[model samples]
Target: MEPIVDTVVIVAICVLGAALARRLGFIAPLVLLVAGLGLSFVPGLPEVHVEPELVLIGILPPLLYVAALQTNLVAFRRALRPILLLAVGLVMFTAFIVGFVVHALLPDVPLAACIAFGAVVAPPDAVSATAIARRIGLPRRVVVILEGESLLNDATALVMVRIAAGALGAAVSFWDIAGQVALKAGVGVLLGLAAAVAAAWLHKRITDPLLDDAVSLLTPFVVVIVAEELHSSSVVAVVVAGLYLGHRIPYLLSATSRLQMDAVWKLITFLLEGVVFLLVGLQLRDLVSHLEADVATTFRVTALVFLTLVAARFLWMYPATYLARLFPRIREREERPPPAVPAVIAWAGMRGVVTLAAALTLPRSANVPGDLFVFVAFAVIVLTLLIHGTTLPMLARGLGVREDTSAEDALAEASVQHAASRAARERLEAAADGAPESVVDRLRALTDSRSNNAWERLGSQAQETPSAAYGRLRREMITAERHVFKIARNEGRISEEVLNRAQRELDLEESQLNRSDD
Candidate 1:
């Protein structure tokens, strides 16, 4: 096999794929996957043989780190019960169901191979779900549940896959597997926490903004390598470290460091997502080449497996969510059970790269029936992407599970608060400059009333006595100033680079001012 993949090709694909994905919207990944498939058909595209070890080492760590950093821990905590059910219970249930179905359908295939198939396809890809979910107005709770599940489910699936793979080659006891799983998971978590704590301490010690940002960038790779070196799941470790670091990033890093780190990660994540999906598409050619079975038979088996997986999610989600509500301790303080959450849960089960990668990496021993597994995995991914991903927005619309307008409302309220805070700070400065006491008192009262109004709006509280009639006017003034700055850059009144820097500074100031009310 050609030496894995060239770095130049990888970089080119990601850069081009991202540009295209942005222009094409939801179909970007689909487009990239198709491109990869087409490229694979060419004579000199280089046979991109994927190693399972490479994926666990190269691809998983940074991806998991980015996912964890972006995840809203507060929102995730709110949906903890649902996440647990989906991530742990539901994934295991799906694996067992898929294993049974695969065994019955393909009796020639070993049970261990069947279980391996199930394990590969169990967890939904975080990148794919987040991309699609953002387009539709998924409620914050639903998004959190999906993200948290994706982040943690890989470890569960990997443990089972390892057990299945081992059993296929030799006799394996359940107790041994269980002990290994516990050891791997426990060690991974401990290592991740230790790494995060060390990084945090180092961050605190270093005050230079540039060095702090550079150190933060190094974290994901460190966490992943450390975990993998210790024979643990790097995916779990990266996530744990990411969550720990992200939660404390604001306190540990300077404002400039925080800004730089956020921008760098966003770019990295975008490229990783593009490359992975493109590779998924490219691997289809290799999978197809190994098949001796009839095309129709393969299609039939794929469809059956796809339907089973979809049906299993619906079966699991409704009862699990309902049961979760029965225990007060399990329910989040702000969480109210949504009547139509079942539909949301069912629709959110879109599989992507992890499944494809696992399938492509299957051992090609003659007894393993690796071709069938790869074909089935690819079939499920395509079907899920087209059937579930394409129709999710329509389903959400039908269920009346529209985007929570609350965040928008909160943002508007935040903008108003920001304007008021700016005004308050200006007045305070003037007071410090020896402004009249009476004028300062009047300005202070205006600030207080504006602040109170913003709080009421954010809390969704009923309107009390109206003290400030010009909150809207103040917001518009701030917005106009931003608009003018943009126009100045476009008209070449200021250099584009300078304009971007100023705009970011203004944006940060606005965010800070809004946060003051909280």
Candidate 2:
């Protein structure tokens, strides 16, 4: 009972914190972290210990899957080079440098254990970064790079963690680590592709949105579990499966199913991220109490490590951006991004739950001071979140690196809508030969209205457009209709089932109108 009650209270606090952040125009995760930290210092409050398995096995997969699902595959492919540089190459570089520095600072700690700690903090979680980017309308290319890096970096860091752990037990050679990487990558990608293909085939047959969403929800967990059992990178497997399925969803699933699945995933992600960030903050008291080193030394090392991590990312980003242009084909294919772009990318390296979780997973016998490593990781997360989360938007704006693609996006949307409307007109012509003229005309009007609304959105917004006015008026009508329906039901003029069915129709139409306004 106590456990259940605690869970409820925690979730309530997370939700409330997030709501407050939204209202105040602050980053929700950072706000939640600060709130949790304050709560942790309250006298008589129980220490909150977030289990690593709970994070690694339970929270991670779904979050990764959702991020992958939302990522534009085409954009991801275009940014593949930069993504790999940061996700794989920079991770290795940061790990080695941090390992050497940590060994120098704490001579008693094994190099392998130090490297493991480095691996624990190498990958930056893009959840917060992407959120800030989208909110501030940063360039789409930058967002793609951040999202793509996040999808794959976890796999790289986890692989490094495993190698370092092996080294702690026995000397691990470069060739051994290389072989493990190839094996894990090969197995994870293959299994993920197979799982996605099978799931896609199954989902196509399941027309019911609820059942389809059920399968969709289960896919990440299933793929992750199987990949883990097969000694592959579960993170890679889940991400690949999600990307594949998300790409195919438009063709494979019904519109209703897609809508339902999206809403479900968004809700799940919101709750999970909220809980994870707050829990991370609530851990401060326990981590500080369990520190194996003096508090002063622990904080000093943490500060140094945090600076090292920041410096390493900036050091890698510039070279990674400019050096890739050495090849003629590469130079011709990709334009050099402005220096500010790289600066923004480098500074957006905020760590999150994955780093803390990885630190907790470090082997007990790895000759690393477990509490110290955890504390450093926690401090890094806190510092990064607090500093980067607050300053990233300001930096991007100050650097004149913001996106101004509204006109371009509107034009693209209008073009797509015109093409869609033309196709629909052809389909209607082919199938509606036997239909009533009124019905055919109504369908045509709706199609034209949709296309026109999209184009109107591109026009100047000095006053309300016809489509906006229509949507606004129609919404009022829907409200009125709903009121009357309730009155009818209250007067026993209609059955409950009838009222519900009628309301559903109105709700769907109102939703369509609202979407058009966007």
Candidate 3:
């Protein structure tokens, strides 16, 4: 009962924190972190201990799944090279280098333990990077690359962590470890693909929105469980399944199902991400109390590790960006990016909850008397989230790394809408032979309105457009209708069902208007 109460309180805090952050024009995770940190120090408060399994097994999958589902598949394919380099190559490089540095700083700790620590902090959290990137309006390609990298980086980092943990117990050959990683990852991918296909097939048969969403919510958890039983990379399994399902569902599912799925996932994502950040911040108080060493030495080592992590990312980004062009086939296939793009990408490597969770999984035997590695991981997460999260937008602006795609996006949208509207109109005409003339005219008006709305958005920003006027008028009328409906319900002139049906209609209309405004 107490645990249930605590969970509810935490979720409530997340909602309030998010709303407050939006009102103050700041990122929700940042705001929630500060809030939780403050709450942790309240006198007589019980320590908030975040269970490692809760984060690793419970929170992580859904968050990653939602990110995978939202990723732009076309953009992901275009940026696959850079994504792989950052996700796989950079993560391995960071872990390897950071391991040696940590070993040099603390020779008492086993090299394997140091490397495991590095692996814990190697992967950047998808929520933190994308939240900051999207908030600051980074280039779409850059966001896509970050999204793609984040979706897979966890698998690479976790695989390293597992191997490093195993080495702490006994001598493990490099090739043997390599073979294990390959087999595990390969199996995970195969299982994920199969799960996605099977799920999609089942969904095509299930038309009920509630049931479809129930299955969608279960996907990440089911995949993760199956991967775990098979000794495979659960992260990869969930991500691959999410990507395939996200891509396939839109083409096959009904509009209602899609709408419900998006709304459900969005709410789940917002609450989960907010709570994760807050939980991380709350861990700080407990972490500091459990430290085995003096504060000064721990602080120094943490600072060094943090600096090495940052420097390593910048070091990896350049060669990875430019050196690939050495191949003639590659040089001809892809255009060179601006010099500053790499800098922005490097600067955006903020760590978040995943690092802390992975660190917590490290055995007590691995760290000896104290969980120094866990403390350091928490410190890195704090520094990265606070420093990088806050300064990234400023850095992006200073570097002139903003992607100005407004004109191009508008042109593309108008073109697509125009073509789609024309096809819709033609289909309507062909089906209208025996239909009422008034009904056909009404359908034609709605089609033209939608097409015109897209084109009007591309018009000059100075004057009021027809679509704008229609939206504004329609919204005002909706508000009046809503007021009347409420009054009718209050006076018992209408039943609850009728009132709900009327409200849903108004909601659908307003939602359309709201999207057009965006």
Number of the top lDDT candidate: 2
Off by over 4 Å in 2: 172-178
lDDT of 1: 0.76
Candidate 3, residue 388: lDDT: 91
Give the clashing pairs for model 2.
none
Q: Which 10 successive residues of model 3 have the least lDDT summed?
A: 169-178
* Clashing residue pairs for model 1: none
Candidate with the greatest TM-score versus the true structure = 2
Residue lDDT tens for model 2, 1-518:
99999999999999999999989989899999999999999998899998988998999999999999888888888888999898888888888888878988998888888888888999998588888888998999999999888888889888989888778847755456657766897799999999999999999899899999999999999998899899999988998998999889999999999989989999999999999999999999999889778878887789889999999999999999998899898899889999999999999999999999999988875357888899899999999999999999999999988988989989999999999999999999999978999999999999999899889988999999999899889989999999999999999999999999999999899988878766
Candidate 1 similarity to native, TM-score: 0.78
TM-scores, all candidates, are 0.78, 0.98, 0.97
lDDT of 1 by residue, 1-518 (tens): 23344766776886787687677774566667767777888886666655666666667778888788777777777677678778777877888788879888888777777777888898887777767777787876777887898898888778778777767866544455557666887888898899999999999889787788678778878887777678787777888898888788778888777777778878877777777777777776777777877887787778879988998888898888677667776554445567676787687787877776677665667777777788788878877876777788888888887677766777787787878788777869765667787877777776776677666565533643342224344456668878998899889899988888887877776665455434
In candidate 1, position 516 carries an lDDT of 42
Tell me the tens digit of each residue's lDDT in model 3 across 1-518.
Answer: 98898889889999999999989999999999999889888887679988878987999999999888887777788888999898878987898788889889888777777777888898998888888888788988899988998999988888888898778846644455557667887998899998898889889999899999999999899999989998899998998898898888777679999999999999899889989998988887898788887887798889999999999999999999999999998899888889999999998898888888888887676344237888899889888989999999999999988877888999899999999999999999888999999999999999998888888877899999998898899999999999999999999999999999999999999998998888
